[model samples]
Target: MNQTDTPDKSDLSSISQAAGKDNACGTNSGTHLSRRGFLKRSATASAGILIVPSFVVSGLGHTAPSDRLNIAGVGVGGRGFSVLQAMENDANIVALCDVDWRYAQRCFDHFPNARKYWDWRVMYEEMLNDIDAVVVATSDHTHAAVAAYAMSLGKHVYVEKPLTHTVYESRLLTRLAAEYRVATQMGNQGASDEGVNLMVEWIRNGEIGEVTHVEAFTDRPIWPQGINTPKDAMPVPDTLNWDLFIGPARMRPYHEIYTPWNFRGFWDFGTGALGDMACHIVHPAFKALELGYPDRVQGSSTLLLQDSAPMAQKVALFYPQRDSSFGRLPAVRLDWYDGGLQPLRPEGWPDGRNMNHRGGGVLFHGTKDTLVCGCYGADPWLLSGRVPSVPQHERRVATNHQLDWIRACKESPDSRTETKSAFHEAGPFNETVVMGVLAVRLQALNKELHWDGENMRFTNISADEELTIIMEEGFSITDGRPSFSRPRTEPINAQAFAEGLIRTQYRSGWSLPPMPA
Candidate 1:
């Protein structure tokens, strides 16, 4: 990773000055830091980490574990609680923030000294200067907003995966981390697994020859989806901030389906099965294959619903040839199966061996042999032989994932504290996974969606223009060119497509922090 990428003036100019829409929590009283000139100041403030990390108390030669960071937590419920537990031992956790106090209370109890807030915007505003780092483990939709604001405050961030709800948001965070020179780590723990490095070594050493295809699957959607919204609104629980829970998504009446662990199935609120699990299954495949973006993507599902994801869906993405030591690699096709779906059993497996364990697994089919492993890249081995001996190049994590990021924030930069899943790699890897989410959304059309990764536009938008795609519900994409003049390359404006999907529109007062141009 490049340690230097100062934000340009133009990037600063684009960030809106309007108080963000989500800062509605009334208790959010604190000094308002100026977003303008913020980037320049952050670059300078980062240098202060070396001078005095506030909480830093060093003895001879190096800082002790007791001299740790003052970190803040957003979404301290469920998985958010787990992340807090993982890092609390090493850091001075200063604040706990969550939308629902009921679910977030356990974490609050764990850290009696920590301040509490339901709105993360409030927490950041009230304690901006005091915090050395931020940890975001919110639902998929709000991840960008919270982390973006935290990074803007010059705090190192560790975001849970899949990093963002949209490809555009992932790209923004990737660029922002580098520009701020803030250490970042995505919460896909397997990126730090020694087994993942072993897999990378085997693939690079051609133990599996050239991988032509990969089939990864998970039995998720253990939540409700492909369903209608509640016909009537439920009374908002006094302990929950329904508006903040909805965050930047367009508002709707509060319902049980949208909260308390079921939100993963909703389109507006969560990222369904694909978003919830693929980041884990695809983590090692991404790093080992050196995948950036798929050249083409398509999907098929039971059906896509307006308010929720399909009951089941499978997406196939093709990544074309790229350079490798194995010489020119052929197009690698990856297929994702979900919601109790499983891929066809591979060839060359021993007569009675199971292809995968119960939860899910990833299989790499190469010309010479096949490799498989459980999720989070665990227990990887050859189909019927001892693990191949290959030289390892990537460094293994010394303690665990979360501690690595925590230590990297204060511990020596030259040491083993550097995280393997830093945003530079995780951002692009996650952007790749969310593409599958988009494909699953379009699966009802039963069409192959062509992607122009460089332009970040769906090349096949023209196909939809040329053919009438009618939904069973009633809406129709009619067969005709767009009224506005298209691009010269038989094109549509990339910026226009970007505005709606790659990054979505924030509700009235909310805006994502802009990245340097």
Candidate 2:
């Protein structure tokens, strides 16, 4: 694994070009921008311009303030309802779509003026002109299909955390967002927290010396395992659109236990503890240290009831890239613990052991000092003996993550802080944490896997083969393959095994846009 910390310049450039291309503006004419016109438009813009569009007094496809950024909510239940409530404060909620009619009915009651649809595709097709943004808070399985389609239609998106169900899906969504040139934000609201910003500055300024190791822990074993639960095929609920719910997954009989909250424990629907909490817990360390993918991930834990579910106590080791700008050290090691697991105390920190609480958070150990953080590592308090000269830092409470997103959407991109909520920053953080889920999957298969960060694959060929087989029986290729790797026999969807990218099957009239030429 070539764990080097340099962004692929070519890839960045392509992203820039994609973002610069003009979007299909009007509903009537999809043929407005010719190839030459697109090239001309792209040539006149700088990379910054790609993110911050110049105000055009008036032109074709130009969005009007009165258009009101028509918006839709894909899953308007629980957290989805919260997302809808947040969006209501900013943009018009023109449509509400959900597989559960009950959820949709509740949302409809809240926004009586908005159109309601049990299917997202119907909502999009019928109200395409009315919608300019989409909020996708559906189950992991349905994320890719809805988000991909929304992006294809030139709509801005705010998808919930863990950005995608699988690695392939994450990269796919990122690519489509760039290609569509629409403003995007992931659901990792802590990315904009003041405390997280302070943590990054402290680490960058060497307040904790050269950070060689980090440990993040979470208590996410609340969901019961589905193992040994008799596969009693029950009739689909009257309010549930079962087929739409199963959008891309291989079909399975309906079970009440698998719906709503319980989906997190199932391999076919969710990525378990790491996927559920990694995005929140790992953000502070990843952003502060500027770490990329890990070189090798090894995990050890007690298997819970479900064979496919993540273990109760798990630890993932991340070996940082040698060329990373975050530190001058040759390499760094990061440990992630969850399900009540705790990190071993550092050599001299008196209160290190005291910081071992349940829930989720991160611990940083440096050559000279240590620091412990809370709220999924988004908030931190320095704890060490070597910091006599260091100044005391205050932590800020982030009352609302959604407000941060709304504020960014309403403000100029350049005016926003570097720590502003952004997919570029948030996406990588998600990738790092979700790796723990992948590690759990590998551990379940009883394979010791070595990762090649530059190649984004296992260094051991046999291990790689085993990973491919376990991911999708025979599917080997991944859409997110690093530029330097050899192509796999299968496509990206096959590589996204448990991410649930392929879990939900769309209804008759719904389909993802064909991959762009």
User: What digit string (tens of lDDT, one per residue) describes model 2 on residues 93-137?
Assistant: 877777665555667678877765555654555565667678888
The sequence of per-residue lDDT tens digits that candidate 1 reaches over residues 288-369 is 8887789889887875655678788888999998986446777889999988898887666668776556467999998888
Off by over 4 Å in 1: 1-66, 324-327, 351-353, 411-417, 444-446, 463-499
309: Cα error in model 1, Å: 0.7
lDDT score for residue 97 of model 2: 70
Best by TM-score: 1
Candidate 1 residue-wise lDDT at 303:
56
Q: What CA RMSD would you report for each candidate? A: 9.6, 13.2
Q: How much is the lDDT of residue 242 in candidate 1?
A: 72
Superposed model 2: Cα runs more than 4 Å off: 1-68, 304-307, 324-330, 347-358, 385-400, 407-421, 444-447, 463-517
Task: State model 1's lDDT.
Answer: 0.73
